[model samples]
Target chain A: MDTEPALFSILRQGQVLVASVHTALDDSQLLRLQRDLVGRVGTDRARGIIIDVAALDVLDSFGSKTLRDIAEIARLRGALTVIVGIQPDVAQAMVELGIGTGAVATALDLEEGMAHLAAALGPAWTP
Target chain B: MPGLTYDAGVGAAVVDSGADGPPEPSAAELHLLVTRVVRARVGNHPAAEDLVQETVARVLAASDRIDGGIEAYAVTTARNVIATMWRDEARFQRYQPRMVDLDEPDAPDMGVLAGEDQVAVRRALESLSVQERSLLLAHEVDGTSLATLAAREGTTAGALGAQLRRLRARMRAEYLIVASHREPPTERCRPVLVAVALRDQRRWREAGVDDHLAGCDFCADVAGPLLESSQQDSGRVAIDVAKDHDVVEARVAVRRLAADLGFDRSDVTLVATVVSEIARNIVKFAERGRMTFEPARSRPGIRIVARDRGPGIEDVELAMRDGYTTYGGLGLGLPGARRIMDEFDIESVPGRGTTITMTRYRKDTR
Candidate 1:
């Protein structure tokens, strides 16, 4: 049997919501992630959302599209979304595959992404 | 579009020569005839019904009395319309000659089910015991490592490997028996495994195993998927990149194609990125071009070819450099694309055109 990790883990950094995805997900998991994030955004009252994909090894077309869609959905709920921690190989692959992550803002790492989110959320957010 | 194969003049001569010509077909009859004509040529394409409606409109517009039968007249008009559409489409083609070889090797028969054969495999798999099914699924679909499985089963890795081999042979034997409905000699059962393992290997040809597979129903049933799967593995998608929006269409097609070919998420994104880069180049440097996505013949990967008949590259080496760009790009398009794919090649002739071919293989599949 293929052992699957938890689809994603959510951390609350003040008003910011950081989702650290650790597994390469199939369609069902992506849908679950979308639904979970949307629901969490409502209850958590997050002003900003940072998706950390540092542990992810790949980001196929479907995965890329799902991320884009997740960002769009979060934006609709009035939270700024930033995708951080794209590996070098993953970034190169993304460029070669012609899948532009144009919809979501991307950062090099979690810290940079959180900084961007902190700036966007304003003086209330220090971390 | 190589879609239309109908011989437009099939029944026209008979209608023209028949004395007093056949009775004029009614509007409803004409609609049916034109629909059949278009469908026969183009199958159930989205444009088929529209072509039939246009044919009906044309028939309505004809003021002069028809000499031949209405069926023949409508058929001729439909053919003319289809031909004109093809001609117009041909004019928009920007790729010179359209296709460049990506090294097509004789595909091996690996007992992988494809198309209708998949149904047979599915039924055969259902007949397997739960444990046997799980073993196969864990190894093949789930991609569980042999070492890990061996550790879990409390057996040496070598023993597990041998056990798996035996299980595969038995499973394939049962699959063959179930699929072909033939009871072969007991000796023939083990040969099925040998036949499957060598299906893609060149040695199978020298050993006369392919010929054996051709004659043996059991072997053929087990190997049918290999034949069709390899065929499906190779395909080309040509996208016309004349406008910025067309790039999206091209990207969508590439992404779908990559996904269908069973590329992992990272690889799919890589394919999409390469396709987009080439397509964006078409929009930028050439103003128009074609991007083709095909399978790499020698390995488990996709081959992408981007060709344009615009002003060719002046410096090949400069274009490949990380920050080099003729059209003020970020200078990373070609280099980034090259870095992502497993193999990359480019050819260009000044004033003629350019062709960039790249391939990305699945590492885990290898």
Candidate 2:
């Protein structure tokens, strides 16, 4: 009788898609995110993806790796991707575990991440 | 002693208390009950039986104040005593390095400098310059700070770090080359070889050793023990968890154990990561805990037990939820650990503590 809530909520701002993740995703959720992103990017033709992860309490190795892969795949599709809002404890654990989010651009929060995208994309960019 | 073993009869008789004006449970009854509780909580621990004995003594000492039934009182007392034991063990494990089973051929054999290995190391070290050899020995064997050594040598810490990193890599490479060929290295090379051998044992940190080894194929060939030639069973590894470093140590021990049990590279990493998550929780929440790795009794697998006396989980079902965190922590730890491991069990009592048991079977081996 009850259905699970969506794991991520996407809002398109001009040429960018700001996907705010609301839960810790498992393998199936990750696949869903990937599929949704592909469908959205195909229709909207977004040039930038900002993944907001402020609600995420933990980013285990698998989750971290998946995010990085998502960023890589987005780049291949001509979209710049940035991750924002890593909690302090999660960051500490990731460093100690030697689980680096390799080559993934990161920002302190959604605002800063948008700033980064706007600056990188130049004056023609709109958020 | 023979009569005391009849705890079941005593318990049964006590059930009909109204018929005899509620006779109190005897010391033997309390002892048996407390022993069962302690043993169930601290399975396979050498101190479990001793802890039960101590609990019974403590309960009897305060027998007068027990308002509730003696069985309930004894169980509560036993739980408190176990918490204190876990706290003490955590403090002790923090100061002491864990003992690992490196004697097995498949163990993480940090090459010992003995016999032919010693001879090769000696020859290798002698090849290095006097200054280089002393620096290696002072840092690796003597346990001197690189900063102090650098001050004496008139170099900055950054420069010294770089120099030592390069020096260690070169020495290890030379030692491995000489060691593989069965040739006694020149005198200039002896001390360097000994330094490499010592670093291999993890007696002290060798700057950039892992990085250098990763890039160098020759050193990789000769660096690790030729354990593939000798098949041996891995004995039990016990890691005391008190801090983040201890968590890392526990993970390394698990990885080695998985390797010893012939798990593939990715499986080894998965097992190690699971250990890391569980051990981290122990340190983060409990400030101390213990992890033990041994052969599972029911199957061909490595069984791991993680026990902590931190504030217990109030809602295990909710905690099992992936994003649930009562302390604003990454809720991913418990759920993530469960996903990685083949088997996971968690037990927690509010105001008491928590224990997690997990096992990863060598399915291929079985």
Best by DockQ: 1
Tell me the fnat of candidate 1.
Answer: 0.20
lDDT of each: 0.69, 0.69
Instruction: Return the DockQ of model 2.
Output: 0.02
Tens digits of per-residue lDDT, candidate 2, B220-325, equal: 3564442112113336665667765576678777777778777765566666666766776777777766677767767677888877667888899998887677
Displacement of residue A72 (Cα, Å) in model 2 is 17
Candidate 1 lDDT for residue B288 = 66
Task: Please list the residue runs of candidate 1 whose C-alpha ends up more than 4 Å from where it truly belongs after superposition.
Answer: A1-5, A124-127, B1-194, B197-200, B203-366
Model 2 CA deviation exceeding 4 Å by range: A1-127, B1-234
TM-score of chain B of 1: 0.37
